[model samples]
Target: MNSAFLFGLLGWLDLFGIAVFATSGALAAARKGQTLVTFAFFALVTGVGGGTVRDLLIGAPVFWVQDSRVPILCLAIALIIWVTPVRIWRAGAVDWFDAMGLAAYSVFGAAKAMQLGIDPVPAAIMGIITACVGGVIRDLLAGEPSIIIRPELYVTAGALSAFSFVALMQTGMDGIVAAAIAFAAGFALRALAIVKGLALPVYRGAAEDE
Candidate 1:
């Protein structure tokens, strides 16, 4: 794939991931009966927090700061939620969006890190950060238990996506093809978690320690 075209596709995927996450944030604010301003705040932070961290760690400009449209996209999501009735928000809609974001952002982040000359293992870690940190920020700000701690396969799903992409790329697969397979792998895991309550088993302390 053309390098420029690959970056363009990755950028679009990142934006789509941001939109899904931002909408989830806005919906969270709506659930809490927060003001529209709060919705915007939550949306922006939740949409960009992970990528911001990723960029900072990589010594790159913060993504939302560099792109004028990123914050605007966050604001748009908040506005959409503000104008819509909660009744219109279907059950499990947020989970579906989250799953999509988890898949898309993981692959996008890994790809970008690889482009920036990051080592493959760390690049995959960056992908997980891009996929989950925003949601963590949202959860903390909203005073909810962080989803990261939940006994679900959330981060594992993201890791699988990121790892899949990196592994495929190492095998000389096309970036776009690798990304598609990675995203599907992650989203499938999350879908099973949501639909079937699949989760990682909680660790139990040693019997003597307990």
Candidate 2:
């Protein structure tokens, strides 16, 4: 796709990513019997945490701050979950939502970095960082073990998508097409991990070799 088309796609994806992440954050709080303030805090932090860090590292203004609607959207999501019946969310919805957000944000991060004149390799790294850090922060705040410590293929899923997006875009693939494939591939991998217990090989270091 052309630059305009790519940028337009990125914009929409960015909004959707924020919404999905915010919902997941709010739902996580729901499981904890949190107050409205905690719900909003979790949603806002989980929604904007990674993108905000990515922007700052890239010398761009933090995204949620630049766009007033971002935080408002996060809060709105939190409110929706807070007012709704807890059972309406279903079990493991947060994990599924987070999986999709990871894929979307990975692509978005790479695209944003590329637009900022960053090289493809670093751009892909930015994608992984963007996909994973928000969840890390969210888990820390929730007093849960982060996914990175889990045996499942989490960050690896992000890496696969980010790398694929960067490679495909460099090979002249349409941006939207690249994003679709990359996001699907990543999400599929994560879904497999969720459904089939797929995971990376364990590292048996010298300490464990004995």
Candidate 3:
């Protein structure tokens, strides 16, 4: 509930999220027959990309660089997946990992911003960046479209989680409690979106290009 305990919890969540993201990214590289170098590249980028961006924007030290554990954890996760059977990298596992990463990063971003004395709105936006930038970078490196640009409810889920965290903070809820609720909400929404093919409605302008 206190700031110290809240931060420790956030650190654990961030590590767990990075591991899951790395595993998913490594599995994707393996499926594409990428070499070990490529696997490590994907794992590192998918694990630390979002957090790096968020920290840079906020003028905080780059997290993984500050704590070697993050990158090491990511590599370990990738190695484990690489040695495992291919079936473990099935679509369902990917979805679950993605959901978990989204939730964890959203909470991490919001909590970090709050600690740094950022306003609620910007903090919420930071949360979205923390949740989506890793996936965007990973997809771009994999020669796939960035998920944030797609209508797959990815950013929406992050926004919802971030806003929830901010609202709870404004209401004087403890940081850890707010973070846990925000993570669960985002994860549930993302899982449902994946299952039901849910998406935000797109605007259609009269212009041909639009």
TM per prediction: 0.96, 0.96, 0.94
Candidates ranked by TM-score, best first? 2, 1, 3
lDDT tens digits, residue span 115-202, model 3: 8888889988998898888888888888877778777788888888889988988998877788889989998899888888789878
Give RMSD (Å) of candidate 1 vs. truth: 1.3
Q: What is the lDDT of candidate 1?
A: 0.91
- Which residue pairs clash in candidate 2? 1-174
Over 4 Å off in model 3, which ranges? 206-210
Error of 2 at 64 (Å): 1.1
Candidate 2 lDDT tens digits, 1-210: 378845699999988888888888888899888999999999999889889889988888788888989999999999999999987877899899999999999999988999888999999999988888888888888888997888988999999999999999999998889999999999999999988888888877976878
User: Which residue pairs collide, candidate 3?
Assistant: none
Pairs in clash, predicted candidate 1: none
Model 2, CA-based lDDT: 0.90
Ranking by lDDT: 1, 2, 3
Q: What is the lDDT of candidate 3?
A: 0.83
